[model samples]
Target: MIGRPLILTTLVVAVLAVAALFVVPRLGGATAEASDLNLEAQPRLGASDAPVQIVVFEDYLCPACGQFAETVFPRLEREFVETGDAALYHKNFVVIGPESERVAHVGECVFREDEAAFWEFKRVAYRSQEGLNERRALDLVSEYLPGVDAEAVRTCAAEDLALEAVRSDVGTAQALGLRGTPSVLVDGSEVTATYAAVRTAVEAALAAR
Candidate 1:
């Protein structure tokens, strides 16, 4: 997530929060080919056969990302993804710090332990993102993950296994030349930087298909 200009500059020297990235794969994963409708990355929303595919690069610690989660994402989910006109794929691009990676690891752990809870964790992460760094954000994972062992979650979040998923996402984002948070690719084109632009792009992609 990209911070507002002021906060972005302030946090740059502090090294607390994270940023987002989006990368397009040249040969594998979701790519330019029509056949690469890989829904395995994020399966909660969207249809594999849908006409419009939206790939998002987000960081849990990015405040601008929180804005998307609150405003744009819900609208997209209700208007396109839920209706099966579009599929939204979530990929982790860790631009923040180790704390950013930790939050992502918690997400992966939540996904492995409980699929439904993973989304819940994402929501909580965004909700609690204000005024917190990576360590504090990682601590808040327990609040949303119902019935999860807090100690275990914390431990796993700090381990390499969970962090690897985040690292891989960063690699993917670098490859795609993603410059900032909440970057989006509609079908095979990257044009979703603003809310208005993304809505228009998604609608057009759906209408075309």
Candidate 2:
């Protein structure tokens, strides 16, 4: 499911991330301890017993996040999430602006009705992120989630459901010392922000298990 534009940039991001590691501040020293893993806060996308956990923090408006969702995410789901090797918990980190939180709130509203809807919104919103703002965030939900109560989602989004949890996610990212969007912590260790690197880390975690 990797698109042409995404494929062109994945490796480039990988290379740059490796080079930037030293320059970027390493917050919690690259390891999120298992005891510190917060599964209760966000929507998790994998089985309970999965040996590895890929905690995702990203903004819907972030382009690097779109690239990750397009290129690395499918493979991760197929080889890890579906196979019960690793779990993914996508947390909201709205660095773009208030609009990012609005979109996240819509996702929260959808999650109340259907977990699947929330995931779908994440995908579609990212694909359709161009020119998106607080107002248009609701429009994307209406267009994409026809089956769900779009109006309710808009209401909840305006009210900002689970807004504290989004703040918590931001704190988690800060503790990890993240430098940018589309970052992952594989088994509590911060790897290069790329699917290939994450997959390799997951394999290592699996082998260790």
Candidate 3:
């Protein structure tokens, strides 16, 4: 019995030491990986059946996010997303803080009304980042999404559905241990945050799936 307890103690100490050395560093590395992954690119761009799936997490206020939207999104949409070769998804990390969260909520509200128009609203929102005002966002949404009722947009955005959607996106980022914007996930694996890196990952995912 004394030998058994001694052996048990030894095993416990070894396990704890191993955890301190290996598990802690791995956890920290995972966190850093997640922070590097978050970005604001739109998600699920191609057909549901499309082999490639890319999930982009981005913050509206991040300059890098702006660059990706302004420079890369259109090209991706035209070349890969529209052509059914690739699909992209969006997760709002809200790195700009409160305002970004508000914008994400509003965008989600717009998405609920009309998914097709949602992309247009996103395009316009990113374009108007400098002069973003919530009220103006509502107005711009109306202008861009012709058939969507602005009042409904406002109400939904301020209420449950859209709020939940935005929260869910944020939650997804947190769950992935991401701390920043411009994150891209290829086949559910976190990778680099650049457009080129994302494109290559998407292509590989497409080939695989």
Candidate 4:
């Protein structure tokens, strides 16, 4: 009887060890692998072959995200994206509310139709972020993104045509265990969401490359 109890305890320990091997990686180790990010069919700024890849996780309704878009993004665009040192990709992590999801859907629709106009839509969304709602966001897109098909964007948002893409972004953010807006990743490592930190990380990645 003693030998049988000891054998059962050993088996239980072995089973837990195997289970942890699979669970631990999903919890933390996956965050370090940029390859895990789903970048396919996503809007990107800068050269495709840039040495460093920068990913920005944001929510449209988040004020901090708006601040980053207005203040830090331009510098990043001029210094890194334009220079071909890095490619920046935007991903959605809709944490605010229903309004945020609505905006994200519209943004994805614009991205699918015209990649260039999507950036304009982003700018206008943040510019008019105060008291923003679904109707205002769509109207802003119509007003600011002249190059985009306004009717098509409206229809797409109403029909939730781009919902899958937005959901994919949300899933990616959740998988990485991110819990906030404006999370910036440089070369697969999380960095402080500031131009100075981003610049430093980009430089370090470039130097390492």
Highest TM-score, which number?
4
Model 4, C-alpha of 186: deviation from truth (Å): 0.5
lDDT of 4 by residue, 1-209 (tens): 57988999999999999999988755542244766777656789987778999889999999999999999999999999999999998999999998898889899999989999988888889999999888998899888888889999999998999999999999888988886889989888888889999999999999987
**Which window of 10 residues has the lowest lDDT sum in candidate 4?**
25-34
lDDT of 2 by residue, 46-107 (tens): 88667888988888888888899998888889889998888888877778887777677666
Best by the lDDT measure: 4
Candidate 4 residue pairs in backbone clash = none
Backbone clashes (count) for model 2: 1
Colliding pairs, model 1: 1-62, 18-96, 19-95, 19-96, 23-176, 24-176
Residue-level lDDT tens digits of model 3 in 39-71: 332334668656665677877767788788898
Candidate 1 C-alpha RMSD relative to the actual structure: 12.2
State candidate 3's TM-score: 0.75
TM-score of 2: 0.81
lDDT of candidate 1 over 88-155, digit per residue (tens): 77778777776777677777767666666677777788888876555665567666566666677666
Task: Looking at model 2, report the run of 10 residues with the lowest lDDT sum.
Answer: 22-31
Q: Determine which window of 10 residues in candidate 3 has minimal summed lDDT.
A: 28-37
Q: By TM-score, highest first, what's the ranking? A: 4, 2, 3, 1
Where is model 2 more than 4 Å wrong at Cα? Answer: 1-29
lDDT at 11 for candidate 4? 97
CA deviation > 4 Å runs, candidate 1 = 1-39, 131-135, 147-152
* Candidate achieving higher lDDT, 2 or 4: 4
